[model samples]
Target chain A: MIVQTALLIGLVLFSVLAILLRDLLKSAISLAAASLFLGIIFFRMNAPYAGVFEISVVAGLITVLFILTIALTKAGDEVRESRVVNWVFPLFFIAFIIIDALVMKGLLRKIPALASGAETGTFGDVLWKGRTFDLVGQIAVILAGVFAVLALFRKGDKHD
Target chain B: MIILFVALPLVVAGILPLVGKVSRRVVPDLLANAALLFLLVYAAITGRHLIAGGPVLQQLSWFGEPVAIRLALDGFSLLMLLAIALVGLAACLFSIDYMEHYGAKANYYALFLVMIAGMNGLVLATDLFNVYLFMEVAAVASYALVAFGLGRDELEAAFKYLLLSVVATAFILISVAVIFGMTGSLDFAAVAKALQELNAGAAVGVASAFFLMGFGLKAALIPFHAWLPDAHPSAPAPISAVLSGLLIKVSGVYAMTRIFLNVFGLTPALSTVLMSLGALSMVVAAFLALGQKDMKRMLAYSSISQVGYVVLGIGIGTPLGIAGGLFHLFNHALAKGLLFLTSGSVQQATGTRDLDEMGGLAKRMPITAATNLVGALSIAGVPPLNGFWSKLIIIIALVQSGHPVFAVIAVLTSVLTLWYYLLMQRKAFFGKLNEKWAAVKEAPFWMTAATVFLALLCVGIGILFSSTVTTWIQPAADVLADGVHAVIGSWGF
Candidate 1:
């Protein structure tokens, strides 16, 4: 429990640093680390399937996409100058976070008890029997995403 | 029938490019438009289904599990599907000429069909994971469509949209996973049942927060609206029509409404949050629009403002208010679709989207100019136009709900909407004819035809508001007013 709490704290700290850091590449990497930590937490909480997906899709695939964007746009080396507004945002964000944390503490304490022994059935059992339409909908989403990415990269030769 | 709505588009999207390769023109266009038209007719014929009486278990097992992908078309789903199909059919018709300038017609049509498929699937979906999936599908297509030009502006805009959209999707996915964890179910009805029986506490709150942010970004509500102006204007015109007209509404507003009203059960706090967001977008977007010099960019900002109205109406959380919101949604789609297509025509003719550079286009392109005027007036809430009736309904609904202040602000914003749209009209169509545009003729036959058709529909729907309300708007509104109780009772779980 102590180790897990320490890891969660580390994850939160890393996420903050990722957003705050100047270097885009480093920020992207830090976000990946944060996602990895989040996946660990998910697994620790007994959501093994979700944890696996969190790591593979969010930590792995999305981080790569962000890195690609940084590379494609040549934005990695761009310096983000510190400004009064930037300073204000962090201060405000921190205040909001503190308030949210206070409100969430009690709620977080009860989650484990709520989720414990919840996964008696296969993932498919709940996903298919209960939510089959959603699965098909998700497939459509993936197809749309794939098409959008391809459309973006296609050559712009005028056909007219 | 429900499955067909999703499957037809998916199958055609797959084969569209190959058909283009063979016929290279007519076949691809015909097939795509025909498919959507068929779906539109299908949805109209089926009407609303009572969950108890309808065939609910239309599944075919996959991988030795009874986990076949299913689609259940309820009133809410049917209403959204109808909008998509109607707008999609018109857009496809317009694209015949509009997309002639853009190369790879087959690929373009393929993406278009896929987006329609994704949206149709999204509306029909009953599962939480599938919603996320279809949302991404639509988002991905829109990102590409936004960047279709491959110009510097298009690429930059697409990238910005892509970044924000990915973040939104991630947030939504995390929330869905949380819900799955909590309820141990991925179905909408099942999750609702679980939530009602359990004291969801913080998890529900957290999940709801994530959904609001994720879908909020998709909706392009105030703070999350940074990408919309850039993305909407950067896309090819028909795409702009789709992006502003249907894409944002389906992927953002419709999704948010479904999840909140049906899945999560709208709470007072959530209602407040929605209303505030709506009010912010309504006011802020209008102010920003007044400052734009580019015609399409201004329209983009106006789209954001119009979306605010829909959100505001829904936020009221009254039966009449919800109906008003849905009515506004239908009107906005038609009017905005017409406006974008006309702007496309103008751009195509004069090689510019800048309001400052255009003047007295009414002489050269009478049809396009007239259509633009009708669209402008309609969107501005001029009486006898569709926009006016919807705005009137929303305002009345607001007053009936005891939010006279919001109603007043809504009226003020309507004036502002008229101001900007008239400004666009004056600069682009009414002043002295720009001598440089002497060579500009009416848009090519097909483009002129499509714009005229849409413009006429806008006027017709407005003039015949009572009839339209009776047939389409009221049924759609009824679904929302029915709310969670309707969903729960109908499902008979």
Candidate 2:
């Protein structure tokens, strides 16, 4: 329990750091650290498939992509953020944490356990047979993302 | 097949980019428009027969074994499907001409079709997780479409929209997670059954709250509506039409009501909350719309306000009220869709969205002005238009339900709606000719045709409302009026 709590704390800390850090490289690294912590939590919670995806896809592949993109682009003119956001985000964050801490424990106690057993079958079985509709949706989303990239990147495209 | 509703557009979308290489303009245009026309025919004509007996449940079988892609179409989903196809085809037709100068027409059509597929999938989905997945599908496509112009305002608006939308989805996901934990099911019928057996009010309330915030943001309900006025106006005009006319209704209102009325079963408390939110959104957004100078921005706020009317009518939780809400939804989809398309025409001709910039456009573009007036009056709830009947039904339902104050509010907002719409009409089209717009021509054939299509439907539905309501709205309202029985009894997987 202590180890799990520490890991959860690490996840939140790194996530907050990812948002707060000014340096793009540091922010990317912080996000990676957060994802790693989350992946560990998922594994500890018996969701190894989710853990693997979180670590490999998000913590590894996405981090690399972010670093590569950041490396390729020169920093543009410094953009100043609003003063309101600096304080407001943290304020909301703290308030949410407080509310979660107060409400979640009692709420968790009240929630009756699921009437059914845990998800069964292999990952492929679940993917192919249990949730085939998701695959269609995923395909459409990927198609959307690809088309978006193509449309947005098309050159010399100015206001009509 | 019901699956075709999702698969057809997605299949076409997948081919469009490749097809762009061969013939960017003509082929993509024809293919995309053809796909939408097929959908319209399938929904408006074929859908009725399929659902006449009862809900059509589909489970695709590969070879001999059935896979778990469960989709269902009932009266309510059929109504939504019909609305999506109609507005989707109109927007696609409008895009034929309007997207000419924007370039990369194939890519544009591809995204548009994908968005339509997403919406259709959402309505047809039998499970909760699938609903979330499909909503995201539509959302990602819209973010790109909103920023398709690649201008500073477009990019900025898209970014803000993306941020808020992410927040909305987070709340929704959290609610889904909580519900899953308690019920161990994501299918609508199973969840409804589980929730009824459990009777865990506090947890259910939490889930419902998260859902309300999520969908309210999607619907652009007041207080959660900061992103819409920016995002709607920033997109290209046809996109604006779809965004205002269809996306919010589909993703926001439709999703919310389906979950609330069918899956969760609307309690009096939930009903009260919904009505309060509806009243708030309708009243506040109407007032906000009254002050806008940008033509599309005004329309965007009006979308929010009208959506409020939809929620209010549905919130009454009666057959007549649900019918009123749904009828308003369909009418607003047509009228608002028409208004936005005409706004696009005006923008294209004049190169501005500022209503105060010019006058006397009626002389130059008579059809556009006429269509624009039709849209404005319909939305403003003027007589002999579809909007009038729907609003009246809602008001009457409200009074019968002992919510006279809300009824009064709805009436006053209608007047406010008329006031601003007239202000827009007078400022842009009525007065002395704006010398700068003298050379502007009527919109190209396709654009004019699209506007006319929706405009005529508004008038036709108005005149033939009883028949239209009997054929379309009654079935849908009956299903919703059935409450939990609509799902638990028939939607078993």
DockQ each: 0.41, 0.66
Encode model 1's per-residue lDDT on B22-122: one tens digit a residue.
Answer: 88678887898788889878777665443325325355566777655655666567668777877787788888888887877777888888888888877
Give TM-scores for every candidate, taking all chains together and pairing residue i with residue i: 0.87, 0.97
C-alpha positional error of residue B204 in candidate 1 after TM-score superposition, expressed in Å:
3.9
What TM-score does each model's chain B reach against the true chain B? 0.96, 0.99
lDDT of 1 at A81: 44
Residue A35 Cα positional deviation in candidate 1, in Å, after optimal superposition: 6.0
Candidate 2 wrong stretches, greater than 4 Å: A74-94, A157-160
A1-160 per-residue lDDT for model 2 (tens digits): 8999789778877897788766678789999999999999999977889999999999999999999998889476564555765786678667867776788777977878765554578899989999999999999999999999999999975442
Lowest lDDT block of 10, candidate 1 chain B:
B48-57
Output the lDDT of residue B301, model 1: 96
lDDT of 1 by residue, A1-160 (tens): 7878667766876687687776788889989999999999989978898899999998999999999998898744557645743685568657866876786686666553434364557887867575566555566556666666656666655764
Instruction: Give the CAPRI class of candidate 2.
Output: medium
lDDT scores in order: 0.82, 0.94
